[model samples]
Target: MSTYDFAVIGAGISGASVAFELQAEARVVLIEAESQPGYHSTGRSAALYTPNFGPPIVRRVNAVGRAFFEAPPDGFAEAPLLSPRGALTLFKSGNEGELAAFLTNGTERDPIHPIPVAEALRLAPLIRPEMVAAAAFEPGVTDMDVAAIHQGFLRGFRRRGGDIRRAQPVTALRRDGATWRVTAGGEEISVATVVNAAGAWGDAVARLAGARPVGLVPKRRTALVIDGPADLDLHGMPLVEFAGDAPYLKPDGGRVMASLADETPVEPQDIQPDDLDVATLVEWLETHTKTSVRKAPRTWAGLRSFVADANPVVGFDPELTGFFWLIGQGGYGIMMAPTLARIAAALATGGNVPADAAAAGVNAADLSPTRFRF
Candidate 1:
């Protein structure tokens, strides 16, 4: 039996990224159940890279991850991975409280300034002239190249002589003292550590190891690609987020990408867009914009898993010495991948979390899986 140093289950952005980072230092194996890697949430991402978004810890990760996204290592990306696309947050006439919090929370990390109706319309041509009472714009947002980032991590992992095993679902786990026996794809393997980056199926994997659940809930979010205005120039348009997340749209080349911004709780499985959601989104879009999407080119959905507090859990279990967690990233996984992976690897190796992450005020106890222990 080849006793490897680390075994990462699941090949989503979280798993692949952690494996990619740790494989260089230890004998590692990256395992995935799908026929290929990134078939789950990674492939189904909205592919946006707004750093000044998400929780404070997430924002810190996004800020640090920008370097890797902007300039990947050699032979990792075919082209530039980021294209500048700013963001606009629109508030209704009566939602002053929500708008104030948004601006206050946002401007701390990046300059988020209130814009008038004319300014908002100029930033996002799709915003209806009558729907906006107040708005804020963050000009530093960009559309992330998720595919390129995934490939870059894989390339780096492979370059360091890491082994990737796809179509391998881990069926069982047995602990022998400090070592772990992992069975996947009819092959038994042994490893010193098991990193659980299973995304929505995280709790189940922990249960298999007799570890307690961490209160992860998977929610479905749907998105659609529709016909954009042929004559309109939307190259530098900011991502317009409407009040209460009712519906939002961003320009994608000649097409427009619209989302209902719905977070319907669901089981972990192949996700599909609901017809009612589609109808609601279309109605909202028509109500908020002059350009109507008569039909959609594509519509799809993905699960975004979150803990009760909506914070990512990325550390080792206090009870289970060798089981590390990298789950509950919600929709912020892609934007926060670089920093999360690096931090996760450091923690797994028994090193301290970065000073920046600590300064971001992420409490170590808040991320521990032992909180659920009876």
Candidate 2:
């Protein structure tokens, strides 16, 4: 018989963040299926805050979000959220043209400049010298402490008198007159509004609520960690990736963390790392780096959900009055969470986009779920 102003489904990064923003002025409850928050993508994220990444709208969201990462709210987190770590994009001979387009790709916010091949190797000494042709380095990229940021939002949300129900999987969503009855863990709660931030399972959750699917395709991405050269200072190395769509390698502790960069379409569920993906990644790592796969490496996979347009869908549903969509963040969820949370909180409460978000050139219409109807 408990009632709340809002019930946010999925206590992952997306849900936890937006719930924190919404609980500021309204009664809010965060419901999670897992016993712990961020059990999926958020926990597994090799997160980096690079403004140059993602599409234009996501970049704008990062524009507004950078300040938050730079200096979060007082008492939000104990330590700084960011660590200095650069990114290097390698061009293997024929791919120099791609680097050319990227440099002049508009907006000086990228923090990347064309670097000599020698300089690129100095930054990431593992790439095969025979294969590298040209390179670009992004000095503005930084490693993000995903856990701290997620925990900060959750802590702040709870500090503001918000409730969080862990291990509660939302089984049913029914509209009772003007109220939304959300059933989770065999208990039902009525709320004036429901915000769906279920990530890869977004469309499924919408179907459960009797809303139309927004064409969300959950894609699985696999990453692995392997041994690095003993003489190399892997700790100080920059994140390295090839030009165009290719596997990426970075330093994790004393080992090299490499990603297959594969986006295979998949169903929404607890995904496991595909053996073929791991094998393919090992081959790529051996070919790209100066390392060999002497033994099996550690591998994991997570889902990145995207809509047809490859941009995030965030707004009130056109047909369902109180059902809001804050899903489809794709791979840019963590970096874009801060501003997206602000925008979602504002839009769900019958308010316009916040001033800071507007100044960042975020067109709310561009992210509206209604765009999928056409």
| Candidate that would win on lDDT | 2
Can you tell me which runs of candidate 1 are displaced by over 4 Å? 95-101
lDDT of 2 at 277: 87
| Candidate 2 lDDT tens digits, 1-374 | 99999999998999999999999999999999999888887877778887887888888898889899999999999999988888988888788888878776436765578999999898888778987999988888888989999999999999999999999999999999999999999999999999999989899999999999999999999998889988888887888988775788888888988888889999998889999989989988888889989988988998989998889999999998799999999888999998899999999998988998898889789999999887
TM-score (all chains, Cα) for each model: 0.93, 0.98
> Each prediction's Cα lDDT score?
0.82, 0.90
1-374, model 1: which lDDT tens digit per residue?
Answer: 76789999888889888998898688899888888688888988878887776776677767777887887778878988898887888887777567767776565556777778788888777667778888888877888888888888888888988888899998887798889999889998999899999989998888877677888899998888877667677767778887676677898776678888789999888788998898788788788876777655588888999998777888888787688889999989988887788888888888877776676665566665655554
- Backbone clash pairs for candidate 2 read none
Q: Lowest-scoring 10 consecutive residues by lDDT in candidate 1?
A: 365-374
**lDDT accuracy of residue 75 in candidate 2:** 97
Which pairs clash in model 1? none
Quote the positional error of residue 109 for candidate 1 in Å. Answer: 4.4
Which regions of candidate 2 fall more than 4 Å away from where they truly are?
Answer: none
